[model samples]
Target: MNTPQKAIALGIGAALIQALMLIAFAWPAANTAPRDLPLAVTGPQAAMVTQKLNQAVPGGFEITRPADEAAARTAIADREVYGAIVTGDGAPRVLVASGASPAVAQQLSAMAQQLSGARPAAVEDVIAADADDPRGAAFGAMVLPLVMAGIAGGVLLSLLVPSVSGRLIGLVGFGVVGGLLSMAIIQGWMSIIPGPYPILAAVAGLVSFAVAGTIVGLATVIGQPGIGLGALTMLLIGNPFSAATTAPEMLPQPWGAIGQFLPPGAAASLLRSVAFFDGAAATQPLMILLAWAALALILLGVGFLTSRGRTPASATTVSAEPVPA
Candidate 1:
């Protein structure tokens, strides 16, 4: 294509790309509402409360009738449910874990107020968020930066480190350094995440490695286009659909569940679990991250072998060629 035509095409493509990004970021936020958010109810009026809640929000909550208030609290603490409602003797009490999801907590509080009508229900934060990040703004803000760091690490390693072995070393180094640095900033400086330092740091590092390693491995096997694909997947789909700023159940149906399978989403969920719920409900997200890491290693090995097979034949052919007079 001529310069003018190419320029016009590029401009149009950029516009379209920008539009797509805006939609990816905005759609979820605009549409966020509890689809099947888990909530536990226990007491003599548990059945009545559940019925009222179902009528009030229709299908907003998935209400589980625990044996009693103690069981409901345990469910919330264990991360099995976002909140619980205790409706028995005196007044109704709502137990919420803001650290698990501030959005969900706020939603539950609002719902409780609505249910109580004239009298406000007692709302207790069973697991409160970090004091500095009561609303979870800082915690939510961390996802994009982590994702960008991982993408940059992988892209740089792929471009600068030619050998697969060198790239592997670089990926590991980046994960370690990046994780520590991120923890220092978010945990130490900003006080965004509250958890055991070592475990939190390890989680951060693993997440970084999972993202960077995936990118590097894909590039190694599929060439330049792989880097683009990796970045697009993490940034466009993973970051937006991660549900870091909101509960996963708040997001659109399949996408919410699908996001948990990706690096950004899994990392966010895992971080929250460790930071707030004392590792409750961490197994699934941990497994997802590990699976990605494993895939990266396997791809790197395959790539190394494939390149090794080509190198010897090319070298042999070059050595056998006769010199020109």
Candidate 2:
């Protein structure tokens, strides 16, 4: 083909790629299962219900049993989990927050059925929100801090750059400032959201720090590879694996299986929990975020230090003494 024709084809291909990505998010990832959704259960015999839930979902979700029925319901209302199971006398009830994503509600409801094996089941939406909220939306558990963190995370990771001499001190300071600022903005947004402020702040800090550290660390290692790596984690793997898109249960086997372990997947469920679950299940997310951030920082520090050591003291030498005047 002629050059002009080839150029036209390449342009078309590029457009097609962008279009596909857009469609991926816009469309329902139907047939996807919950990989590692965190769910709360309440029942007369809590132990039996919790065990049954775990067995029913398998790799799809993590199950938690609150101290009491009220607590489990409150957890769901707060968005601590995707949904909860209330087991009592006549029929089992699935408790979910209205503000949560509808897809999740449905999936959790199905899990209740699977566990019951045709036993009567009912659904109770404890923290029902107004109709204005989007359907199947994640819980207020995530709130503003998480939003801020997400924005900051995306920006920081997207801008990573590598250099032979190591990053400039000014750049490091700038990145830190930027990351913190992102955190602050998210903290501010938390007030407007339904969930409380502390949850937002904590979630935001974790997401922002981990993402930023990831960018910084990757750039220190491979320069250009940082961009691709960030994209792989944040865009490709992160979004799909995230519980934010659909409750893990609704997702088919493969997609749901791995979602919970991935960063975004874990963060989405955890953030929502803090916002909606009344902070019942904040520990797991916090631990994951801390681990990722620490690792990234350590790697970045080592890279910087090693790079400096590799530089010879004679790098700036001026021929010893100017050879003899």
Candidate 3:
């Protein structure tokens, strides 16, 4: 076997690995089903509503009984439940937080309709998706740009700015500017999302920094291979695992759990909370992003120390050379 053959084989192997990763992440999306999605039931007929919904889709909902429709609405706004059913003699009222998840809202509406039989349940979207993009497609689409911005920051900083301090400063600046610009376009100009620009921008900047810092840290420690690894983790694994297009519970086993911890998922959840859930659900996801950013900083520090240690020895070796020949 020659060098060329070895190189070809290695290239083929790398491609195969990428293909497998794509399949692993993408396959679950096609097979999504509701699993323990939260819902609130209220009033005297709560028991019947719960029973019927559970019968319709077993293990699909974690049903809670609120005192009345007002409480149900509060639960939805607080991100306690994805949707709610207020049972009454005339007709059942289904309250959904479409701003949290349009997919979940649509599914819940359908389920309510099925349970109502001939008469359709009255559905109300308490926190609807943005007026411009009512389906919430913009939220899902935003993930790609966030990921790209992070990648650009990481790669460009690493290449253009050689020093550790310079790279860090550059990445931070890039993240802040990029985040603000994105908010201006999405919220200010387009009016796709509502106000609270400062909070939104901060969350976006945090997400970008978390992702970019992780990539830069990995690359500093592992050289060229680190860049590929960063991409594989953030892009291939993080995006689909995020379940941005659908509720996390809708994803097949383990994936939903996995996605929640990733940067992209955390960011998406944070944005949704700020935009519609009144920032009630932001804490956990914010913690996740902060943890990632902290770990990346630690890794970067380690890389800096290791490189500094190697420099003196490298210089000594260069100086001590010229031993006869």
Candidate 4:
């Protein structure tokens, strides 16, 4: 009931929430399962390879038969598939797209090794992660920072800018500049993300806008509680559910599906698509981000309209009310 008690309760509640979130996220990662992970197969004996793979790890791969090794490579580069198995005169080799997901590449490579038996097979990384940080650490590393940026952008603009137009402009400008700067640091300095600088930067900008807009719009509609709600959704729920370090399918049911629908997850997907897949798998994620941004704008407009309507009504009611002695 007292100040100290309230502060203690708040601290305890926050700690518990953080602990639960940690466990929820770590459990899935600690117990990863290969569930319909995408893979491509091509060569003279593609069908036979598929059958063998199916037998080895049932429900592990959602196999696609690319026309040939070339097509398979193209698919890998495009992130259509995590890896591909090519059969030939020599030992069958597994081609992996480590850039998209290093853990997936490792899983496929291990599977390939097991299948080879007495004769060993080669495991090639068709699209490797950054040489400096081959495990794609930088990609995973960016997730939390980006989320924080979005939240900060939204909360700050909502509090500082009085007018709707000013807030909108401020958030947009922040996203663009912040995104480009972050991209330059990650891609240019760290070399974590490869080339195509402008495109990657644009993806970053889009993600920032989605995050900032949503938060700002919520604040406009709901006041201070909106800031806390935004943080909970984007940071607490969104980040852990994103499965950035691991494949979404690898996570438990419902969570994986839920993560895909959130802004953080969508942003992560778009970042991967642009950085390694040449933007081949960008449509869905891009649309998701755009939709969030649109929703934010709509909410802001509605809030403004509602507030204006209420102002006149309150003024009239005050004049109508009798003064007390």
Among these predictions, the greatest lDDT belongs to 1
lDDT of each: 0.91, 0.60, 0.85, 0.84
Clashes of each: 0, 24, 0, 0
RMSD of every prediction: 2.0, 6.5, 3.0, 3.3
TM-score of candidate 4 on Cα atoms, chains taken together: 0.88
**Can you write out model 2's per-residue Cα lDDT over 1-325, one digit (the tens) per residue?**
9999999999998898688666544443644656667787766766887666567667766778787777886666655576787777866788866445666766666666776766757877775533444453423333333433443554454354344233334234444664455445533542323465555655655665566566566666666576456645665555654657456555655555465665666677675566555666667767777776776677677777777678677776667455576
Q: Model 2, stretches more than 4 Å misplaced?
A: 1-28, 33-94, 98-101, 106-122, 127-192, 312-322
**Which digits, one per residue and each the tens of the lDDT, describe model 1 over residues 196-241?**
9888888889989989999999999999988988988999999999
Worst 10 residues of 4 by lDDT: 311-320
Best by TM-score: 1
| lDDT-best of 1 and 4 | 1
Clashing pairs in 4: none
Cα lDDT of model 4 overall? 0.84
* TM-scores for candidates 1 onward, in order: 0.95, 0.62, 0.92, 0.88
**Per-residue lDDT for 107 in model 2?**
65
Error of 1 at 177 (Å): 1.0
